[model samples]
Target chain A: MSELAMHEIDRLKENLAERAAAEGLIDVSYRLVDSPVGQLMLAATGRGIVRVAFAAEDFDAVLDSLAEKVGVRVLHRAAPLDAAAMQLDEYFAHARTGFELNLDHRLSSGYRLEVQLALPRIEYGHTASYKAMAAVTGRPAAVRAVGTACATNPLPILVPCHRVLRSDGSLGGYLGGLDAKRALLSLEQDPFGN
Target chain B: MRLHGVKMKTNPPFELVVREHGPAVLRMCTALLRPGPDAQDAWSETFLAALRAYPGLEPGANVQAWLITIARRKAIDSLRARHPVPVDSLPEQAAPIDGFGPDGLFENAGLWDALGTLTELQRKVIGYHYLLGFPYAEIPGFLGGSAASLRRAAADGIKSLRKLLDVSEES
Candidate 1:
């Protein structure tokens, strides 16, 4: 074959590879949610919610993290999160109060799990101090530790760490940011208020 | 404030739209700006802006194009803020090519180095069209120019790069 023909063949192969890779990426299910804090992109495996990211966060990181955790290459598609996105839209619209979807909690580890386990118990329109959360976890003096746990909570709003507050009736630090914390608190008080 | 009333109307099923477009937008940003911390920051900001404006997107529109445009604007703003001097200002080092096959087509590190020498706009056009396989029509919308202008920009950029790389290959 002539060099030009060889080049043409090479180009065709490259195009085929690129198409296959793109098709693979498009196979993953995806959705967006109007969370109290901001718009969120959610990705899921066949198991459960694999990744969630704020619009501002590097979404590639979320996908990469999911790929690492699931031990499979995550294809980017919007089908999986369709139900979750609807539920989230309802939650934001004040038509719903809680998310009832199955979650893949494999990413939560150690102290983060302890904090997350304490989150759902934090009733809507209410708050819990870090000390209170620590006390509930049978580590009464580990308020700082509980705060660290909250900071590391991978699922954020889903885990309800925003309900964990400072001991002094002030808002504590949130992994998603203070504005998110405030929005969640405000939404709980009056889901339609924000 | 009633200014909140002006918030864009968000369509239902928000996560799906974001997931589909997120990687493309990230790729665009990475192509436009230097990879690393700054690009990461810009990526996040772009998504935040998208989230805030999600409610306003019309149903069944091209969400990928919309997100890419937002990312492109955010990247430009970041470049302005950081005032990344010039591509030539940095040392002329080549990025190691990964995931290439045995064909040796990508082994030409000098070609990539020459590509790096182009202006930020030129580099972005090349990356999006040649590397990422985005359609030529989409280039104008992302770069905020006419389709003809984008085509010319891409052609000129490629011509300049071939010359630069050819010289380097001879050396």
Candidate 2:
């Protein structure tokens, strides 16, 4: 497309996004935010932030999942995600230790929700074992389930799933992959359960 | 690794759908109506409507055709809203075509006027067949005309458009 055509179409899309959002036509709004780990695709519902996806997860696939799992009225507007994006930027800069944003946990439920909800209490610069997390959730025998919760955490950083580790203190699996897990843990200056 | 090679029937993200088809839909809207607020509204309405109904659409469906169908409907609705009385055809206008207005959208005012001079059916045929390149056979299903008749309409529309554009250029 020519520059003039591109400008006109962008104006049209911006107008559409605003009007659709005001009229209650937007079901999911999303924007991409940069982080120490990589570019993150943040998507939210009317309730709160829903999914924060890594670039490696394939943004197109992530959006498809959002459309299928949430609502199909997905748009690329940054208004709803501005607070979350700003906070994330602050966190990456080591200026913020915790999130003050509303989160939508519709993507997880039951034991997963229980496990994820307990993660924030782990504190910055501290790691918790899956076995310990299971015990904290009152399911000491479901250490594997705790691992599953961390592995499939719909909201990764904000929920702090990277804090969960193996009983031996080895890095466990993470939804954003183990490398991202290491990057986030080091960024927090993880003292390894100290 | 075993499952990586398997073919999945995943629906494309709606974002991709909009990115790929948005420009064409906007162009179609402007051609169907004049490029301005009304045309922009029709483009937005078409996408919103498409997004609402997109999940139910078949995976093998022709996306462009589906979008153009929606665009046409939204454009007609816009026309209806602007004119209270049923506008079967546009009345002949004797006013000289204006040059570009303050709004950037009016840059193509002459072309828009030339398009406006074509009859509704002729305009539809020319826009769909020549501008957007919808095949004659495919157009009948949406526009409700025989392929033979549509071909004739397009020919006549093209002739009139050429004459109008030539006159505008000379003056």
Best by TM-score: 2
Cα distance off (Å), candidate 1, residue A26: 10
Which parts of model 2 are misplaced by more than 4 Å?
A190-194, B1-13, B36-38, B52-62, B79-125, B128-171
| Per-prediction CA RMSD (Å) | 18.6, 9.8
Q: To one decimal, what is the Cα RMSD in angstroms of model 1 from the true structure?
A: 18.6
- Whole-model Cα lDDT per candidate? 0.61, 0.76
lDDT of 2 by residue, A15-63 (tens): 7788778888787899998887889999999999999999988888788
The interface root-mean-square deviation of each model, in the order shown, is 13.3, 2.1
Candidate 2 per-residue lDDT over residues B1-171, each given as its tens digit? 113334435445666778887876776687766677877888889998887787787764666667766776676567557645433342221122223111211234465567778888888766655444446765575567699999899778767766876645343
Which residue runs of candidate 1 sit more than 4 Å off their true CA positions? Answer: A1-36, A192-194, B1-171
Model 2: residue B50 alpha-carbon error in angstroms: 3.0
Q: Weakest 10 consecutive residues, lDDT, candidate 2 chain A?
A: A185-194
| Per-model TM-score on C-alpha atoms | 0.48, 0.73
CAPRI category for model 1: incorrect
